[model samples]
Target: MPELPEVEVVRRGLDAHVTGRTITAVEVLNLRAVRRHEPGPADFAGRLAGRSVVAASRRGKYLWLELDGAEAIIAHLGMSGQMLVQPEGVADEKHLRVRVRFADGGPELRFVDQRTFGGLALADMVEAAGAAVPAPVAHIARDPMDPAFDPDAAVTALRRKRTGVKRALLDQTLVSGVGNIYADESLWRTKLHWARPTEKLTRAQAGELLSAATEVMTEALAAGGTSFDALYVNVNGQSGYFERSLAVYGQEGKPCRRCGAEIRRDPFMNRSSYSCPRCQPMPRNPHV
Candidate 1:
């Protein structure tokens, strides 16, 4: 799945080419593409047609285009989704799901998803934290990279969780944009076991974990985020190089970068977690 850095790169691309453009036409190549638009494809196309995109914004892993009205087109790139901006006459991608053409005859905005897990939706905006965001996800917590993120408040809240540290980090209500890969990387950086009890962490330790997450993600954002496969790429179809710099996420049975001990992979919530066994020892009585 695309995380904050990967999604932010796409948002930046859209802001560069798609913002300020008036939608002259909308082609829903597949009904599943607009599955999130509860009013259906016809309404989706009708509602988008003359509205100009004012801005391309993102909240954590969520991306959206704010239109002239108090509505926006929200997108979530579920596993294998790509937002591409191509020349008008370019060939349609093999999995092209939606296409948006502009009135100015500029390059077209294309949404392509191989798994179909991603979709588009028209959402009304609601005021939250002095900014307008899609009403459905207004309750989500601000991410570490977000300017509005409060480090003190985030650490305080994280220490209050009764769950395991990694589980708490994965909770969107607690902290946003962190997915499995980054979660393991952040833990590796902080030298904190994934199963450590959140409530047991000191305020300083909690803050360090948040700082680690921000540091690693900022680095990933600079590197254009991790891309182990072609499924995740920037709007211009460029792959990220962060995968080559990963510390532990997928380095199973490999030597730890810090202590030279073997890195380990353990089952975690239907997924897998990678860590340096010597650096991040398991807790005596790990919280569930």
Candidate 2:
């Protein structure tokens, strides 16, 4: 699952290469690729042909290509999904699910997904958080990197949650863009245990946690996002270098960079959470 930073990197690439280009043709190689486009593959292809992409936009982990009309094409880049821009004569990728040719006949946009969990959908533009977003993304909260993101409102939303602090942070409605990896990193930076109760946190502590999340994500974006494997890559098929900069996310049994305490991993929501026991002391009444 690509997080906000990874998705943002893709969006930036699309903005640079795909925007302003008119779709000359669309080939849906797999029906599952446009499963969300309800009207079937023919209608999906018909609607996209000849339409120009006005902009490439994103909210949280959702990426979309705003078309000439009020509709946008939303891309769901599930675990192994990728949106690549390749030269016209390049060999098609083995897992290529959708091939989009432009009027310019230069490079083509390809949607390749090995796991087939991702898909494309045409959605009507709807107002969300004062911006025009695809209807499917209307309910999602603005991410920390969004220019209109309100940190104070986000802090209030975090404290309002009765769940553990990390769980609250992972809630997209509370604060978008913080996933499991970044959530642990943010908690570690704030010196807060994953199981700490959100309501127990002071306003200052909540603000600091949000700030840490923003800072870490900003750094991750600069490093092209953390890629642990080949599944996650940019439009040019380049992996991010941020994995080498991670502190406590997957550093189980490793020495903490700050306090020199051994890092530990705990089972969390069918996944894992890593932290330093000494720095982030467990709350007496842990929510977990």
Q: Cα lDDT of model 1 overall?
A: 0.90
Q: What are the models' TM-scores?
A: 0.97, 0.96
180-215: candidate 1 lDDT, tens digit per residue: 989999999999999999978999999999999999
Tens digits of per-residue lDDT for model 2 on 1-288? 588999999999999999999999999999999999999999998999999999999888889999988999999888788999999989999999999999999899999999998899999998876789899888889999999999999999999999999999999888888889899999999999999999899999999999999999999999999887689889999999998999998899999999999999999889999999999999999999
Q: Assess the local accuracy of residue 167 in candidate 2 as a C-alpha lDDT between 0 and 100.
A: 94
The lDDT of each candidate is 0.90, 0.93
What TM-score does prediction 1 earn? 0.97
Best by TM-score: 1
- Candidate 1 C-alpha error for residue 140, in Å: 1.5
TM-score of 2: 0.96
Residue 32, model 1, lDDT: 95
Off by over 4 Å in 1: none
Count of clashes, each model: 0, 0
